[model samples]
Target: ARNAGIERATSEWIAFLDSDDYYWPEGLSTLRLVATLTGASIVCGMLSDADPGRLVPEELQVSIADQFLAVMAFRGVVPPLSMSSSAIRRDVVDTVGTFSRSHGTAEDREFWIRAAARFPVGIAFRPVAHYRIDHGHGKNDAHFASGAKLYVLRRIFREVIQNPVVEARLRSDPASDVFYRLHQSHLLCLDAAIRIRAGEMISAASTLSDAAVLCHTADELYCLIRELAYFLTFPRSDPYAATLRCSRWLVTLARETARSGDRRLTDALLVRASDAIYYTARQLRRSCGEQLAWRTVIAGLRVVPTIRSAKSFLRFLAESPRHTGHSLMYPRNQRG
Candidate 1:
């Protein structure tokens, strides 16, 4: 299909977009300018998740070097492309061959991996497309079960480690480091989760050991570790409050990091934090009841930002002896 689309090209430049999105008035002009300046085979802009309401760009405009390094240390920046907002040079596509249909759900991410392997990539951080998010029947509703997530993680890891082209890309370039680390931590986290879920006690221990060896404790790897630790340490009935506390705090941390211009690290941090919240909520909600769980979630969300002050926040966090009964003794970690 991509071949057919390329073969019937109507112009020297061709752009890509999914059916559910719209191009902004500035998109073409921006693409042209980026193409002229970079002489790049591909040009990309931001993607908005909300309706003129919420604009989320595909490219974050922070320091690329820091972003790449952080991702290498941990899996950060796993998602980059907004298909509707990206433009590709005709010659580049023809030279590289079209997208393969075999990749399944991660087709876009896989394409970027292949493209970055071959040519110089460029990004434009301006909002170029609007991605309608709340469409009730949209494809975004897919349930990311623990089982499915495990499969995706394994495939990503296998591809990154075993593919010769990808390995070569990693060896020579600093820019590719983010993708490598981002995928690496992802695999480790998912592998750990799978072992625990499958009741493979020895296997889970082995994977966790390997993960520790690989330096997966970076902030990006924290959420996975937090989850794995929670599941392994706490009773099924008691994890929500603790999980909620961690999730709220982690999100606040990510936001602050992004605001501070360290978004690459923050991005990875956000994913780990997000996964922690998700699994915790899913596991607890079914057994413990959402209403009861949400009260704690709401309380944690309220207090996280205040914790930035540290001094007072620490006192407050430590006031309860154990925050949310999860044994979160924050002021203890902060004593100078």
Candidate 2:
């Protein structure tokens, strides 16, 4: 849809704003002054998210192609100005190419990456637009929360960052390995996130195992774990709520990591995750009745096969009612 709009544009500059979003009164004029002064093919203005008081421009910051590309590639954090607040020179669009239909939710990020690789990008720290976030859909661009962005991450990994020339350029940098690992970890964690959301535990486990065993070294694997930790956001909401959110994923990740030949890391993670889930299950039993909590207990037991879990299993067997499996044959009021 954006590409189609670009095709029909006949101006020297193209600024994109969605129907639901709007530009500040000084937005276009601010970008125009900066574009004319800096000669940047792409000019990005800050939105309300950058800083509430950062609406006035002090200076137009020019981002070097290599530095910009490296930041996006390695840091796994995108503080770049967004499309809603950016204006690109009409001619640059042809070379940077159209917004990719294949990148799913990351087309904008992917486009800026490609643009930074070739053309100069200018940043104005003034608020240029009031962009609305659709919280209900789980699309937060600031931190890359959308699992759909995995499409473009895969492409950049395969096509841009791993290209021989690109790799050679970063090889001389002292922090190259750190940068590379962080970016690599984002790919690993995001892929895991998508699979887990889709209920494809086997696939997610296999991917994590491959990363731990085949794809990464010790340092790199640690980066992967750290990135995964940030994504999970457990322990904060933790003993019960946090456990309910992140412990299951940790348990799954630990199981797979252990299978990939690292038993040492498994114990601590498994214990924490399983303990929380186990306690939550027992609590559920008090309020929701036995049958519902039984399922939670079963999940906890799957995570950690400890003596406590065994005891809980036996206790439930002796105290809980059995499932005859024929109660549905009769009406609900008449069934046992």
Candidate 3:
């Protein structure tokens, strides 16, 4: 239906807006001005979640040298350039083709990936669109469920990773290696989350290990560790099993980071893994009052850097007595 509309439209430039989202009064004008000035095939404007309550800023055009990297950084979780917030030169669409129904709910994402890969993408840093957060159960909500989200992510990964054009582009540039790793890591994390939610503990652990290998930055490693903690701590099935799997993966990841000579990341992973073990043990004690010896937990704690250990000790002391009871009750298992 959207493709048909695009085909029939007479305009040289195209913009889209769904029924649930709206553009600010000046959105079209701002986009047109940006496209005119930058000559970019695609122009994206700043998107806001709520009303600006003030006049939109003057259009500030910025060139995106690496469209894939720029879009990945800008969009984060959401699709890059929501339909309501971007305008595209018609010829680019004609050349790259329109949205594909086969990609399912990730059509916008796939389209943006193709467009960005093929042409320059410009940003207009003025709030030109407001993407309303719908509370109702809509089509989008259904697509956000575990099965649907996983399917979309897998499709996106296959499309981006398997595309010969993207592969060639990355191989041509030495600086693109990090970005490629970052992209792969991001997809692996998403896949791992879905697997964890489905109670595929071992598979999740393996996927996370792959993600950890690609993580060069502390921030990336920390984010991945936090996701692991969240899913393992709040497992849908067996929390103990989830925690055990996560603890093992984190210990392995810590060793890898240490080998990479990233002390901060290594320490952070150790701290996170220890916390997972500590919480899991506490949960076990509370639920079954059964003491389980874990060599992995001790190994993680034994390797914690001195500075990180001091911080962990201070944090533990600040917690309530009930929170610290589990650690104190159990004989600390010693291993490295």
Candidate 4:
């Protein structure tokens, strides 16, 4: 229906805005100027959350490969550009084809990836739209279930793998292999997150371990660690067991990083491992008593890092009480 509407329109350029999103007053003019200046088939602009922001660059051009890498690196939480913030040349659409309805939830993202593979894309580092986050009432409502989201994400990646242009680009670039692995790891981690939410702790842990094996870079490792933290802290039965497993992984990863000569990252991992153990101890203390919590921490210190002093242990002991009973590891209100 959307494609048919675009086809029937008489305009030389087309811009898309979702029903819940709105465009800035000068959005059309800005995109038109960018398209003309860069001779690009598609032009996208920066988006504001619910407020207008200043324009920094008049126009900027980004290669399709860079865009693809960025999306993969961020695990699709951040798209290369939002559909509502983009404008397309009519001719380019005629050549590259229209959006696919078969893609389920992420049809717009699929179309953008395909278009990017075939055309030059320009970006205006200026607000052209406001992406209204609809809180719990949005498409991402928890009632939808995470498994459905995982299926949609998997389907999108399968389409990417089948795309000739994207495959050809991957073949030409050796570094693309690493990016592809990271993308795969990200998908697995996402699946694990969903499983964790569903209280499938064993399955989630298995999937997360698989993702950890595929991680080769510091960024990938760090992201995996963060996801593990979230899983441990997520509201679930036997969260203490999950925390123990996560702390073990962190210690193992820290050892690996230390051997690889990344002392800074190793130190960070060790600190997080300690935190995880301390969090577990705090939980035990609340249910049982201070003696058991101290015992748990002392036992954990033997496997991971030892606390420098009793004061530091007391500090760790003090911190987790404040954050007890929270399901989310990170702030829910923060945008991806």
Candidate 5:
């Protein structure tokens, strides 16, 4: 649907909005200012679950350069920006190609990977749109219930991971080790998660053991938990529901990974799994409503009362990074 709209748009600068999401006027202005100042083919602002003047009050990092893929693959969890909060020049769009119909739920992430590789992506610290999450459940085998989300993820890896262009760009980057570590960790976790979902305990356990070895720090494991939650993508009504599911998956896999391995690694996975829940719950202070927001918080922290604080949580608001996401540099001379 978005691709069709892109085909029909007559404007040189194209922006998108979903039915449930709306752009903030100030946010659009910020994006335009960033694009104009930087001549970036793509510019993105933050997204708020509620309509807000800004997502956060603190001064946030605003990036301008061809490091979108670096940030994305390094972060290894979510996209650096939401497409709803982003605008692209027509020429860049034509060059990068439209969103993939094949990805279904993750087309935006796929598009960002391709576009960001070709152009520098500009980031402006502002809330660009009110992002209403999908919380509705599937009834009687509808709405991504029948293993469709997994299939979409598999397809995404097949296309983006196999594409030589993005892979080469990432490999050539100076920060290639961290990018590969994070990226590889996520891929391993994805395979393990799929195994856990399929009741393949032995396979899931073996994969988790390898994933633990690949993850060098608690921070990496923190991102891994978040990645699993984001990848789960179902029952989105509660932000932490995915984390809870991730925790369960980890515990189940841990039970199996424990059978044979360093007991310390097994213990580490259990600890990180619990910690991830607390961290996510603490971070999601949605402006939607106090009651609902706390529900997400309480749901997470209630399980394991140990909460660890980190400034990195603010990135969720400032970056609006979704599932692994991109760079485009638009030149002023090319525009009419």
Candidate 6:
């Protein structure tokens, strides 16, 4: 395959393209600019799913250390096979070797992993390619497989251990490692609950037990306990009733926290409480046969002055991130 391509190629640079893919106008120009400025051997660009689309922009690291850390922190997760989105120097390929055909499902991801480790990689932040997201004929499952998340976590653990740059950073900020592990564990728990909701109780319990191992702090434990309570009562109770009860609990908690006179805490709690109510309203809107806009929710909120510490919480909640992405199971897990 390499010989065939090399014989026909006349260009100084080479880029990849799969049968069904194509590039945007600005993509190659962005890659060319980066290569010219940095003398980079490889350039990675952004890719969008052929259907719904990507959640984040194409990310790059200023240094190998930063790259290593980000990849490790997020676990050894790789993007989909859309290597054609990137452009590479022909000389770089000559030195590093051609792509491997061995990977059955994730060939492109494997290629980039090797490339980034071997050479200076420039990034073009512009979205370039359209990727075909196979839906498996409407039996589409977006959640990670049984052990896939854990598998990636373990791989990231190994990579960081091997990379001196990442190891030093972890040693310098030991809490960061704890924080990552805590998040990984929390996701595992959330996945378990979602599986249970999808009718996989045995798997849920097994996964939750594994997640319990990652719990390190009382706050972490508290979050899991609350989630457990919610899940346990979820099936038996009406969804609206559950949402209302949870909203009331959150509101009471925020009110009590506000009474303590800690301005930041008061605002934070209020924002969280209001956001919870807002989300519940969204879920209930369809079930209750009513549609709501953000403006409506805000208009209906009790009057609270933005100038006051507690009042800011309500305002913050009103402007909180919404329709941004899927909400993780335990909102508290978002913070350290």
The most accurate candidate by lDDT is 3
Tens digits of per-residue lDDT for model 5, 199-279: 787887777667667777766655565565455544555556666776666666667767896575566556666666545
Tens digit of per-residue lDDT, candidate 3, span 203-311: 7656666787787766667666665554334232344555666666566656765665756656776778767656554444333333342332333355443455455
Encode model 1's per-residue lDDT on 177-236: one tens digit a residue.
555555665566567656655656446545554554455345545644553443332222
How big is the positional error of residue 2 in model 2, measured in Å on the Cα after superposition? 1.1
lDDT for each residue of candidate 6 in 1-336, tens digit (9 for 90 to 100): 543674578898777776445666555776677678667777666675432232344453321122322222233212321466767777766754555554223334434544444455666555666544221311111212332333343344334344443344456764666646765775675566466556565566566656655765545544553443343222112434444443444344335434544344344434444544455445334323233323324432542223342453345344544434323211332322
Off by over 4 Å in 1: 1-4, 53-79, 136-140, 161-164, 167-184, 193-213, 216-336
What lDDT does each candidate get? Answer: 0.52, 0.59, 0.63, 0.62, 0.62, 0.47
Work out the TM-score per prediction.
Answer: 0.56, 0.51, 0.62, 0.59, 0.73, 0.40
Can you write out model 2's per-residue Cα lDDT over 1-336, one digit (the tens) per residue? 899989899998999996545788777898887787778888877665322343355554534233343335443322355778889997777775778786556577667766665566666766677654221223433224444345556666556675444455467667666556555555766687668767787687766654544324544444455445444543332223444566667777677767766674455456555555665555455434455556666655765577756776566545544445443222244344
Residue 264 Cα positional deviation in candidate 3, in Å, after optimal superposition: 6.2
lDDT of 1: 0.52
TM-score ranking of the models: 5, 3, 4, 1, 2, 6
Q: Write the per-residue lDDT of candidate 4 for residues 12-49, one digit (tens) a residue.
A: 88888876578887877877878777788788877765
- Candidate 2: list runs displaced more than 4 Å: 49-67, 70-73, 76-78, 134-152, 161-183, 198-336
Candidate 6 segments whose C-alpha is farther than 4 A from its true place: 1-10, 49-81, 91-96, 132-201, 208-336
Query: On TM-score, who's better, 2 or 4?
Result: 4
lDDT (Cα) of model 6? 0.47
RMSD, every candidate, angstroms = 11.4, 13.2, 11.3, 11.0, 11.8, 12.4
